[model samples]
Target: MTPPRLTPVAERAVLVEFGTVVDAAVHAAVLALDRALGADPVPGQVEVVPAMVNLLVVFDPLVTDHAAVRAALASRLADLVPEAGQGAVHEVPVCYDGAFGRDLAAVAAQAGCSVEAVIAAHLAGEYHVAMYGFAPGYAYLTGVPEPIRLPRKPAPVRGVPAGSVIIAAGQCLVTTLTMPTGWWVIGRSPTPILTGDPARPFLFAVGDRVRFRRVGVDALAGTQSGALPAPGGA
Candidate 1:
């Protein structure tokens, strides 16, 4: 495998880039480097943030310069191993009826299938938490089934409710805050995915797996206010 290119970011961070393709292999490599750094950090390393295809290593400028940090990373990269174990699998309960799934019929029409088929294809997918962005506690999940995959809408929809399960560009995400989105809102999950506590703010993390379980709208009533139960490993 080709080694990732390291670029200095400002004066306090270094970016380790593993190409620009957003696929599983590149993401695994990024995670491997992140794991290695967490186990044995370079001098002055403060935080390592993983994204789709790169890692940002932040360090204190006072303790070490960029050269020393880069050298330390080079040594560690020579023997980096990708993480092996599976992350926790969260089963999210979603209601796909009526108002909860405003875009289901549209998605079905676009996919050349029935509305039920659209929901079925979505539930069949085993999604992976690729990264977190856009908002706090909001995770970008990959692995949407090919049949139901579609690009983002040309225009953004305003005031999409929190907990809306939206999909676009072969990825899925649950809205953590009330905001506008161009993705198709296929369903809604009543479970609260964001914990307000400072110690643990989000329910899901990068590399975690997520599966959707279908439920009626009645099941969602009065269940949207508490933290989700701890996820279990697959």
Candidate 2:
């Protein structure tokens, strides 16, 4: 594994960057370092925020300086072992009928395929939770198949419902709130990704794997059980 470059961020944090690109290997390295720091934190380390190609390690300024933190990070990097398949995998059930998939036909037309073919292409993809942003429970999932990949709309659409599964720029996302979006809404999942509990607010963490299962509209009823289904085989 290549050593990550450490850049001082303000006075209390260091940005450990693996690379400039959004490659899976780079993301895996970021998550590996994150796990390392979480398991064995350096002196004064307070928090670590993992991202696509980097992570921010925040330290208590009163307890440690940049030099000391950098030294500790170097030592940890020397001993860091790459972890394989590090996060939990979830199989999400999505309904592609009716209002849930208003953009399905459009996406199909753009991709030069049938709506069913588009759905099949989407379900065939095994996405990874790259990061979470935009909203509390919003997850940015990566690894969308090339055939179904499309750019986000030039303008955001208003009143998009929550639980809507959308894709754009080779990424997949499930809307956590009724908000405007520019991505194509191909389907909606019934699983409650956001639990109101403060202890575990979001359903997915960075690096988790996600697979979609196609289900009919009738199957969506009574499926919102306040938590995602247990992780199972793809």
Candidate 3:
């Protein structure tokens, strides 16, 4: 299905929805628009965020009015070509033992599988970074297998530690900061993407493909010098 017509998201932003549903075609279109905005930022463009199936264009009201910016974006939307979801595949190492994977047993039980089966299912799936939100450098990934589509906790935890790998509603998320989340926590990774530095903050971009590899806790805490590759999904 084609995306819905462009609409005003806010006073200074427009939401270009590719479709109401989450699918490969919609996701690719959103990424293409996001790439186009990045490659050739419009005069009034301030930020372009790629969500699950929508592209949000934030504009500078002082430089150009909202209507003008929206018109400009709408004009260029016709030139977009579906990206085919092509991108580098990053491998994110995760430690799934002890405190890192306190919820692993629980998740496995819910899935009616062993802990090993849970780990295998999560690691083997090819997931796409659908959107980056809910926190700094926190990526909402798609392609969680059917077996692991457990609902979030009835009550969210007061604080979930950083680097926690969580799953809910067929999506996966990695926490870069300690935040309350209703999703089930499966594991943790120390080399999380979001850094505190404003200068070098988020590492992953929208449309980046990611895969999780189960590793020992000691390996995760040890020096990552050349141990793990960069996050570009190579």
Clashes of each: 0, 0, 3
Model 3 scores worst on lDDT over the 10 consecutive residues at 225-234
TM-score list, all predictions:
0.91, 0.89, 0.88
Error of 1 at 106 (Å): 1.0
Instruction: Give the C-alpha miss distance for residue 118 in model 1, angstroms.
Output: 0.8
Top candidate (TM-score): 1
Off by over 4 Å in 2: 197-199, 222-234
If ranked by TM-score, best first, what sequence of candidates would result?
1, 2, 3
lDDT by residue (tens digit), candidate 2, 8-58? 999999999999988878888888888899989999999998888888999
Q: Can you give the lDDT of residue 189 in candidate 1? A: 90
Q: Could you tell me how far off, in angstroms, the CA of residue 135 lies in candidate 3 after the best superposition?
A: 1.6
In candidate 2, the residue pairs with backbone N, CA or C atoms under 3 Å apart (3 or more residues apart, or in different chains) clash, namely none
Give the total clashing residue pairs for model 2: 0
Model 3, position 74, has a per-residue lDDT of 70
lDDT score, candidate 1: 0.85
Report model 1's TM-score to 2 decimal places.
Answer: 0.91
